[model samples]
Target: MNDTNIKWDKIFYGRAWIANIIDIIQTKDILQSFYFKRYLLRAMMAGFIISIITVFVLMVKTTFSLDWGPGLVNMIGAITFSFALVLILFTNSELLTSNFMYFTVGLYYKLIKPYRVLNIFMLCFIGNIIGACVLFGLMRLSDVLTPDMVTMLDQTIETKIHTYTFQNILVRAIFANFFINITLVIAMQIDDVVAKMFVMMFGVTIFAFMGYEHVVYNSCLFVAGLFYEVDHLALWPALKNIVASFIGNYIGGGLIIGLFYAYLNDHGQFKTHRNK
Candidate 1:
């Protein structure tokens, strides 16, 4: 084959991408045990690790005095935050936002039952929150932050708590996970580690820099804020944000990307492929 054809074979697009998603759903079915309970702990662990990284990133950004102009700070921060998803993907964790796509694909193909998928999603969601809360408690106890870092953390929390409305959170959540699901779905079609990393970073950057909502990441930050005694971040508002964002993420990942891709590929026909 010519060099162009050879290059093309190294990539997955079109029918191959769709077929890979089908394969992914099948693999998810086989891994039901992990999904049901084990993945929850794994996801929690992943959240803890990611939250630490997030703290570092926020702290570092605070240390920098460079006047990089509008959007530059967030750009740097977003790229740093992108590592969270990379860690999740590499570690085989069950983050809720990402799983929206996976569970949807499984359900669409009838490879897994609805109740089972819900069980896994709910477990993963709660697990992520618990993991983040643990980290928050530890961080508070350790007194690990410098005064500036604490200020930064407080400011971060303040913004999240004070700046957003219910509508703002919902809209941003939709697009945020739209980009995220693109990353997860497209990454599924590839086999190369480097390629996967690049895809994930790009997807995460888009989501973060755009100021979109991601439920797990938000949970980490929000809970961490609670440790700081951010008054605006009352339990009720935080819970509301989580619920709205969760629904938005489900729509973006599960409906917009996952179901759309399945429908496009095979009109989302169940009868023919249900047995597979």
Candidate 2:
């Protein structure tokens, strides 16, 4: 076959990117329409899993930071932290960051309405917060917050809230979800479980190690801080970071990746293929 006639999906070893995007929209439609309770539960589950993993990452980093220092500690923490996304994806949990891309694509194709998108976003965000709070309460009850762990969390929160400029947080937030959703989009076109896990780990680790802001992860951290008597954590600054991260994540994932891909692949040729 000529290059122009090549079956691109075969080259990708799975469905084409546009096909994957359509599949995501259809799958989400069913869940959102008939199984919304489950959808909300999955969002909460994602928040819970991330919160638990964040604590473990802080604990591990705290233990190693003294001997390994910041660079190595961050690398280790990043790698360890990545498993949270892996778990979330495998469990079919809903994450706001990835959803930013998914729903944006759905919107582009007129598969979902704007108001419904906003509703889903709000529901996922609120559910994530609820999940984070529940995890914090469980940790408190279990008495798992050690002095070092608390200290680590406080320091982390301080950097996120007080140390960085608003512009810095915004940029970092953009890159964070950009990496995450890019990984998700590519992973959707692959079939191997191990490959998907590796892609997720690599993408998450890059963002974590770079100290990029993620809205959901930041929410979990902030919730933990509220549960504890943290020295450096303040309400206003935390809110600022959250707001900046939320906007930046939408720009990066929804506009940059989702719209760009939809526009690229949903032109005349793909529409004709779809009609066929």
Best by lDDT: 2
Q: TM-score of model 1 relative to the true fold?
A: 0.85
TM-score to native of every candidate shown: 0.85, 0.91
Steric clash pairs (candidate 1)? none
lDDT score of residue 55 within candidate 1: 85
What TM-score would you give candidate 2 relative to the actual structure? 0.91
Best by TM-score: 2
lDDT score for residue 243 of model 1 = 83
Distance from true position, residue 197, model 2, in Å? 0.7
